[model samples]
Target: MSRDDKGTISVRLVNEALLAFTSAALPAEQLLHQLGLVSVDLTDTDARIDVADFSKLWRRLARHFDDEFFGMNARRMRAGSFAFVCRAAMAQQTLDGALRVALDFFGLTFEGFRGELSRSESLAEITLSETSNVPPLRAFSYFTFWMLLHGLACWLVGRRIPLLAVELRCDEPDYTDDYRVMFSRNLRFARPTTRIIFAAEVLDLPVRRSEQELHSFLAHAPSNILVKYRDTTSLASRIKAQLREVPAEQWPTSEALAQTLCVSGSTLRRRLADAGQTYQAIKDQVRQEMATLWLADASITYAEIAERLGFADVSSFYKAFRKWSGTNPGQYRSLILRADEPIASRFP
Candidate 1:
């Protein structure tokens, strides 16, 4: 559940996301197959989809529909709408100014819903409200809006603007665990309004990304925005980074890792438990991320990937990959290769 482990998204989340397509009477099953996901994947409540594929789904829908918001709003968010917003915000002097500019753009662009930024003495808030015409947005749409705004705010200031808490109006959905990892763990569902609360001082942080960096950033688009900008200060992120410096076979035992971090094994377990993570989960996440990254390279054989990931054999790797991504590694690779413009190549 660590943010650093943006390797897979829950099947529950995928279902919630598909609600948009279903509501619009779009062909959801065909889209799933195009992304190498089968009906069986949706049937498993515990299954997960590779994050890259999920991003592809986002872009595919956006381009074909010409609505970046996935037709969730009455007014279409035209293709390249987000890019224009980014450009407008990039000229602002501070995070506060940048956020206001972006929020204003969204306010004018979308017909029914608008984002507003306000602050009390100690805390700042970004609240989303339905103004007039459109139907109330689903919980998934609200969260997706927050993700884009929050992610962009972090990138603008070149830091993770920690959320004090998140207030959602809709009832908490089944994939609450994913929400905990994506936003703050201190989520309040069935609240009066849907807004993100954070410390006011972040408003003063300078907008640090330059025009040149913005080009590359936009090139990656929604995929980069989805997986990047996680709060890396978490203990899990630090330990995951430590694990990545060596082959997975050489990763330390839980007790040994705790000792290195200058804590007792019991304390380490307790701390990670508080964060909804476990030692084995972290290891699996690291392995899963590496597996997908390596699979992007056609030269790497299944046996080689297995050996490198510290798997005993190819069969074991296949089982673990299936568990992690809900698809075999070969099928995953085929999906990537089949993408009209593969997301893997974009990263390279």
Candidate 2:
């Protein structure tokens, strides 16, 4: 779509996704025409489509296929990104050892996003963030990258530990059903950020694929695969989750938490210091997270969530949610739920 009408999905991911969908059978021209575009300009990586015409193209394609065009794009990106991650992971001796390789080398295959990986005694979270200006497709691309990471990790281990949770920063409707079908997990919408949360134990799963096999696969890997995690994780996700459980007024202080963890306040400060986190950092995280969650839940009154979150009132809550997610809670929830319904149903 035109950059103005709606953001175009990542060109690289979109290309790779489309390639996988056609099994490399569809020609470039045919694919563009199918999307209802008169032509394509691949020379410029950030390609544009006629947004006004997208619906027509999408509908025409939908008539011939049972699945939605966007869904097909999601599936294709998932497979291609999965293959790229598996190959990278196979290059390392241990799952933990290979994380850097997975993060750094992913760029060689995919573009348009970055990721950050962190480890704790109980959990390891890989936060995926969109780096492109293409809002329309960036969220989908980010989701595809996340699905690839989770899906391939499970596939490579020959077992599914599943994610502890999948969080999307976008304030869209409940695509939880589609997300569940794709990632096989509980999905949270209007989260402060996008992430795939899993028990650290999953990182211990052995890599079964051989390097030679991995090398062969990478040789033909598409150019659209994404490779690095951003610095979005740190304390943001944890803080946000904690906010959901604790009221803003009652939120724990960094010192109080340090005592609970049986450490000195200074020590607690030092740890978070090392990680580039702080009490205020956590507070902001919680605020953003709760705002998103409250917005997504149609059952929850805005005023109730606002009071719980320690906002002054409904208007304050509304202003904050808008600032965090870019859209009011109502609009975000509607978009996500509608987009995700078909995908979610597939799992059932």
Candidate 3:
């Protein structure tokens, strides 16, 4: 397909791919015809399509086959402009250079989407903002775009896997199994916005693609993909974000936390206890998750990790690592390093 014509791969392709593994399925031509009538004029395989046209078709198709349409849309819709820019950036010699490329060119890729790669304390958040009226499709499109970006980054770094957590702004449903399968994480639904949370350390992974390879990829990068809506924050999501900010080392005592949250200490404790967790427990859980990512790298030493985590000393770091992982830092690092070697070897 021509670059402009290659909007997003249609849901027809995905459905066909899935049907390949099953028997007694819909015919490919029939499926394609139905998708075409609902979406773009697929009969003219080379026809160009933009976000507005795609969104209209998606809304129509969604009404007829909400589940299938949303599923396929979630898988295919991506940040086409961002993808092109990222591919170009990957051609640069260093990660820093590539990041500069993203910063400089991201605006040129998508007109409405706003993105910021910013540092908050020690954490670097790559935030993407999408303002659209159709919240579900928009959220799904952004979710898919983030997944593609994450997947592409892993592919470049030679770590072809998903991130730690994929947070979605959509409502809770039985989509957990599919979300986990796609994102490889603790999937959170009914949140404020769609986000893929990973360690900032991932940005340090070395770029493997050469300038020529990147040029080739960008030369044919798909650019006419549709945009979808992402919704605003809900009350529960606001609470979750507030709790997320209280990392283990920074978590206050129950009374202190309750006061900070503007509630009585006993009430706060009782609420969390009823949810089957305590404030301390959630803080530890978040810390443990963060620690796992940090420990996976060989370059970071135990002392440095302890200091970063606000631990008292190496002994404390070791103890906590063992408690969280059931293994010492040395053993955990060894296992990760060994797993990493094969990935590195493939890229090399």
Candidate 4:
């Protein structure tokens, strides 16, 4: 899917939902009209939907069943379930604290299931540690809960926390053409457990929300959450994610990267400019990170690292490295080696 398509969702996400409603013998046509749907077939898995439309449909369903989970189970997860969690979460002073509260909220309310908070030196992760069987939570439950926490986490911190990756126990579904939209950062499927990986900095981000803000936030409920968190990525960062997939010896040019994201050169530049970022700055950052990793090896020659990082010559690489690190690559490597930090430690 193209970048702009990130804001829309595949109808596949709604197929199970529509079927569940249809099986219950709801008048499908009337229901579709009520939800502002244009199409007659609610089961069109290939059709795409604007997230706003999807959110409206979701709210209608939630109110109809009085279950936020849309009868995914016998339990009625009342309409206020999300609001109550938000109220509790808003009290926390930091994203870390708020995340814990949200997780515990799910654990206590969604019995038999367990969730966890963990961290590596560079990542803060949340995972569903156990599954429930009392009535069994469906796979969609896992994603909803994960997204709730991720979205709320972003809301709490007042910034996108850079959700780096997602791991799912189920295989990639047919409806995920939209997943590549804004969520193209990283998506993994058929993993052992459902998980969301966040950049470690998220742990320390302070909760910028307040009681006043909570009111506006709660007023929107799941709609605000359903919308993809777009601010989490900059054009440069998006490019960097793509760069990792390419051969390090060369990186995509600005025009090429813009084309890859399906935007024009001017549009990309204008958007990046709006974000106070420049393409060159992003390119340099990607190059720096790659160079640091190569230099950490201690086997690759400086010239080879230079060549691979796309430098015109060893001297140019030296100049750029010095500008980036305030020290030569060798010294940066030695410092990290002495400190016993990985190459990634070179950057914040």
Question: What is each predicted model's overall lDDT from 0 to 1?
Answer: 0.74, 0.52, 0.49, 0.66
Q: Please report the candidate that would top TM-score against the real structure.
A: 4
**Can you rank all candidates by TM-score, best first?**
4, 1, 3, 2
TM-score of 1: 0.64
| TM-score, per-candidate, Cα-based | 0.64, 0.39, 0.41, 0.70
**Tens digit of per-residue lDDT, candidate 3, span 284-318:** 55565566667756688888888777789999988
Which residue pairs in candidate 4 collide? none
Candidate 2 has an lDDT of 0.52
lDDT of 4: 0.66
Residues 212-329 of candidate 1 have per-residue lDDT tens digits of: 9889887776666665665333788888779889998899999999999999999999999997789998888778768866775789999999999999999999999877655677
Worst 10 residues of 1 by lDDT: 339-348
Better of 3 and 4 by lDDT: 4
Ranking by lDDT: 1, 4, 2, 3
lDDT score at residue 47, model 2, on the 0-100 scale: 59
Stretches > 4 Å off in candidate 1: 2-5, 23-26, 34-40, 132-136, 231-348
Which candidate do you rate higher for lDDT, 1 or 2? 1
Error of 2 at 316 (Å): 40
Query: Where does candidate 3 have its weakest 10-residue lDDT segment?
Result: 224-233
Mark the 10 consecutive residues where model 4 has the least summed lDDT: 339-348
